[model samples]
Target: MEEMSTILSDLDEIKSALKKSVTKSDLTDIVKSIVKEMLEENKKEMETRVKEIEDVYMRKCGDLQDKIDGLGLEMESLRELNAKKDTAIRNLNATLDDAMRIANEARSRSNYNEQYSRKNNIKIFGLKESNGENVSSEVCKMLKSPAKVELKEEEILAAHRLPSKFTNAPRPVILKVKNTDIKSRVMKQRAQVKSAGIRISHDVTLLNTRLVQRLSNHENVSQVWYYNGSVFAKLVDSDARIKFDITDDVDLKIRKKLRHPST
Candidate 1:
């Protein structure tokens, strides 16, 4: 009987131990399932966060691209405006050049016409003057004696004393003849009156007078004179005659003629 009791006790002990082992295994399986569930939840949250970051990055890149496109368009517009301004400036310069050319042509024509009107007039220097004197009669008598040219008072269109800058000297005389032929005859006899301290010249424009004075002062010019309303210059030691006008740059012309005689 004792042996039967001992065997029953051992069996009970074995059954209790098997029940504890089974409980321990069930607890381990439950812990593993809970850990797996937590891992899956964390993975899902991380995926959501990654997706949000990608969306924000794409939006920022799109905004940057739009700004770059806008700047490119603005730059192109500025380039077009600059091109138009450059063209406008060039056109304005061309118009100004044309205006200057037209003005120069008009001035030249006016000077030519003024010189032509005084064709039959003569200027006499070193003529005696009085407070109240008959200038026409004196001119006629002087021409007859010294110049040896006969002139009637009726042939003289006008004779008068011109204003002189020299206060102490006698004023010059301006004589206008009826015809160019009579003027030519008097001019031919001008050398004969040089002994009487008298001088005669054509009535030239003020511009021609200044030009003649300048040419007379030039070192290369030997003689300067006016004939038939035109100015002429003789080069020193050279028989070449140079004809100048009011529009001529005498210095430049002389330099060019000296450099190239053929010109």
Candidate 2:
């Protein structure tokens, strides 16, 4: 543009200089030639400018294509990396699940052992107590009378009142018998004793108590009772009497019964 402006200014000066001696026809021809040359130069300059812009645009397009190709490769690599991580995570979760199952099994075994130790025991509540009361004699006498379960005093392995849970009432008596038969007999005759303001239940371990609580929460279960070491349940919806072994996973067993009621 600057060169074209300079050429136009020089032509104007020459026109002024030649105007005094030049005829009209010669001046018109001279000015026409100069205008034609100026137009040719301007067209070449425009073409050159267009070619330069084309070159710059093509280089930028090639650079952008290279960047896009690099991005595609990076994305593919990231996808492969994520796939490997997903497999590793799945394997880790499986291992964790196996470890948890083994741990739970071991804990269940421990709880079973604890509960087994208290299998041949019965707990008697609503019994009066004094400081020097012979717990074994008192328990045997009560069983022989209202409980109607003939139990020898010698069959009583151990006897004691539990630690006082409340000051307003007497503590329940815990009686460990020599065999499970005695405890079963006591539970069998519990209804007769219950009528005389006496409550008889199995001497349960802490683990057994939790199991009983879970069983109690079952919708179909009307009453859950334990005798000796075994668990017995009566369903409200059906006469389907369910029995479970004295295992630590009694809650699991009870829940299984609820899920498959026919079983």
Clashes of each: 0, 0
The TM-score that candidate 2 achieves is 0.72
* Candidate 1 local lDDT, 121-190, one digit each (tens): 9999988888899999988888888878898999999999998899998899999999899889889988
Specify the poorest-scoring 10-residue window by lDDT in model 1: 103-112
TM-score top scorer: 2
In candidate 2 the C-alpha lDDT for residue 192 amounts to 90
1-263 per-residue lDDT for model 2 (tens digits) = 99999999999999988886688988799999999999999999999999999999999999999999999999999999999999999999999999888887776678667778988878888988888999998887887788677888899889998988699998999889988776777788989999888898877777667667777897757898765455678877767777654344555765777689887
TM-score of every candidate relative to the true structure:
0.66, 0.72
Total residue pair clashes for candidate 1: 0
- Candidate 1 is scored at a TM of 0.66
- Score each candidate by Cα lDDT: 0.88, 0.82
The alpha-carbon RMSD values of the candidates against the true structure, listed in the order shown, are 7.8, 9.4
lDDT of 1: 0.88
